[model samples]
Target: MTLHDDAVRVLKDWTAPDAPDGAQEQLRLDYLDHLVSHRDGLWRSCLPAHLTASAVVVDPVQGRVLLTLHPKVGRWLQMGGHCEPEDGTLAAAALREATEESGIPGLRLLGDGGGGPIPVRLDRHRVRCTGRGRPENVHLDVQYVALAPAGAEASISEESLDLRWFGYGALPELTDRSVRELVALARRTTG
Candidate 1:
């Protein structure tokens, strides 16, 4: 199946985690609708909003997560970005971003224990995809958790100004609420 087709399938098949406000359910439906309505929804060029893939790399043994200081956003965030044409599936894209950004070999996305590589969370947020003075766009992020091999050491990439590991509870103050929530959800999912 094509990348678009894979995206549609994953969104349709995804079961959003419970939220008090039913926000996740609504967002899941909205993403599914976006894919159905906008054939170009998964690509970065898609206007207004587009799907992005991200993964939080967890070191189960060390109990820490690797985060990148995004150059443009200038905040502590997980490794992820636009899905590329070469990505065959949503899971593949997330894994690729984690591997490329973290520079940690043998990183593997955590699965549902039964179903393969299910996303742990979804975040919709406004971003300045373009440089300064350009109008912002929204990103529909499909988030997952990846496990770094024991003793894994991370190196910086061009995509990030800095890369470091933060304890599950010690996430830097620079991180926003979305990263906090995603890390919590990822931890619970891993447990």
Candidate 2:
């Protein structure tokens, strides 16, 4: 099956208690339906809505999370981005992004043992279309929790201005609510 097909199946089977309400769940279902209905829905350039994967990386021993300073958005956020065609699954995409952006290897998805990559959160947020000259679009983000190996060191990539670990209670002021929510969910899931 194609990556898009896998995404459809994964989202269909996945459930989250932090989905906020019925509307959020409906939005996820709608995203799945959109993926099924459109041939190019999985691609990043798929106009208004497309699938994105991200991770809230944490060092359980340190009680801290690794966040990147996104240059484009000017916010400290989790490591994630658009799904690449080479990604075999949404979980793989999330892991790939986390590893690539955080410069930390051996990070494991928290709930990804044998059942597949279970999302820790589902967030749909609007992103301004500045680079491509397109209008504002929605990123249907599938979020996962990745545990960083103890004593792991992180380096910033070209995509981010800075990368650092922040204590859960001392997150940066620029961090967004969605990111905070993802971190909380990750802590709960791991605990």
Candidate 3:
């Protein structure tokens, strides 16, 4: 199927009962509509491709953010995974992933500007892999910000060697540029 059609299919999964409510839903629908309307045929050819959703959980109090040292890429990255049909919304998918990867239950999802305990509507970006000999591996990531309580416990999943919080100012030492940008963006927007 075409990319737009695929996006629509994914959107249906996102809006199910388990999904986030109101403005977050609207943002997700709007984003899907934009994706559906703008394929222009090229993305259609990239069929069978995978789409992923991720969450960046930030502890504003410590000026620190959570990251995973992914086993596959061996780089520090945000928490996320492939968008499965069961995941109702992009944010839901992100939350599910963050919960699973970080082993942090009851994570509060914050979007861009909601006054709820957790804000809603966060920045989304695409990841283009650039290793020495490998071509780019593209991941369309729908990023959401959430909060993990201070000194909240975290553990490394088999998929990652390390799962830890780092001071935003020290993100430069992290292995991935995309994650660094994500950290920077989270600091700006969260601030």
Candidate 4:
């Protein structure tokens, strides 16, 4: 199956805990429907809504997370970006982004205890038009958690202004709620 097919299958099969007022649950269903309705929905350039994969990278022993200072958003956020054709699964795409952004290898995804990547969180957020001549779009992000190897040192990439490991209790002020949610989920699952 192609990436789009895999996404459709994954989203359709994924079941999360109760979302407050069932809003998140409804969004998941809607995302699945959007995927089915738009053939190019899985691509980043599709506009309006597209698939993005990201991961909260943690060092389990240290109980800290690695965050990137995104150049465009100017926020300390998780490592992730648009899905590429080479990505075979959402988890793979997330892993790829984590590795690329963190400059860390040998990272392992925390599983949901069902032998699959743990679904840490889901977020739908808007992207600003950053001189790309494209209108603002919505990113339907699939978030996961990756455990970094001990002694893993991160090198800053062009996509980020800085990379740093923040202890859970000392997260930067710029770390958003979505990232905090993902980190909390990761801690619960990995611990």
Candidate 5:
């Protein structure tokens, strides 16, 4: 199946967590609708908005989470970016991004108790990664949680100015509320 098909399947099967008024449920439906209308919704060129996959790299054993100091956004955030042609599934995309950006090998995604990559959370945020001449973009992010190998050492990549682990309680002040919420959900999932 195509990556778009897989994304539709994953979202269909996922049960959004903590939907007090079905808010998360609404977002899920919106994403499904977006994909239905735009076959290219999964790629970078589909903007003014497109789907993105990301993961919170957590080393629960060490009580820490890895974040990148993004060069474009200039804030510490999770590892993720546009979907690629080689990405077979949304989960694979998230894992690939986490592995690539974290510079940590043997990294595995945290499942939703059913051994599935059902995202821990879904976040939509404005970003300037669309480039200089284009309009601003919205990343309808499918966020997952990835468990890093023991004693994982991070090396900075070109996408980030620095890579570092922060205590669960000590996330930098430079992050947005979405990141902070992602971390909190990840902590509850892993710890």
Candidate 6:
């Protein structure tokens, strides 16, 4: 399926309520428990499980946060992607994504430069082909926080249809609840 098409599918899953039979709901709960139970050990092991990460870039002086409009997820998101084997560190991956997506060269490490094994909630979303024609099943992602140097020049990439900085009190019209929550979390930390 095309990235656009897969996105539509995931959105439907996210928004639509599944009035599944009681047994089915129980099954889902059981699966989720199993997934969580194994996730930590899995993360430490060499396995192609649903593992990924992202960075929350904040401009503290401006009291605003940086967000990217990802083509696949089709929503504004933290700068992040899959954790590749060769990545020296998770924080480095987040830094790489933040710079590549924003063209903001002077982002500074904040909080713990290294982040996670923090549990994150994943939502269904899609993205354009990073290069391949077929769309991929995107993972639910965990992200870390990095502070952007005040007055750093930043421009949005094609991966993002738009990019903007939003203050704690004022946020753009957005559909992703996780993005909003992250913004609020960053605001609390910064303030």
Give each model a TM-score.
0.97, 0.93, 0.65, 0.93, 0.96, 0.63
lDDT of 6 at 84: 48
lDDT of 1 at 165: 95
Off by over 4 Å in 5: none
Give the TM-score comparing model 4 with the true structure, all chains together. 0.93
lDDT of 5 at 15: 87
Residue pairs with backbone atoms closer than 3 Å in model 1 (clashes): none
- Per-candidate RMSD, Å: 0.9, 1.6, 8.2, 1.5, 1.1, 10.2
Give a tens-digit lDDT track for model 1, residues 89-146. Answer: 9999999999999999899998878878988889999998965898999999999999
Instruction: Note the Cα lDDT for every prediction shown.
Output: 0.91, 0.86, 0.63, 0.85, 0.91, 0.57
Which tens-of-lDDT digit does each residue in 70-96 have in candidate 4?
Answer: 999999999999889899988899999
- Candidate 1's C-alpha lDDT? 0.91
Ranking of predictions according to lDDT:
1, 5, 2, 4, 3, 6
Candidate 3's clash total is: 10
Off by over 4 Å in 1: none
Winner by lDDT between candidate 6 and candidate 4: 4
Against the true structure, candidate 3 reaches a TM-score of: 0.65
What digit string (tens of lDDT, one per residue) describes model 2 on residues 1-191?
88888888888887746444576577678888888777788677888888889998899888899999999899999999998989999889999999999999999987766886688778888997437576888888888999999899999999999999999889899988989888887877777
- Which regions in candidate 3 have their CA more than 4 angstroms from the true location? 1-48, 112-137
TM-score of 5: 0.96
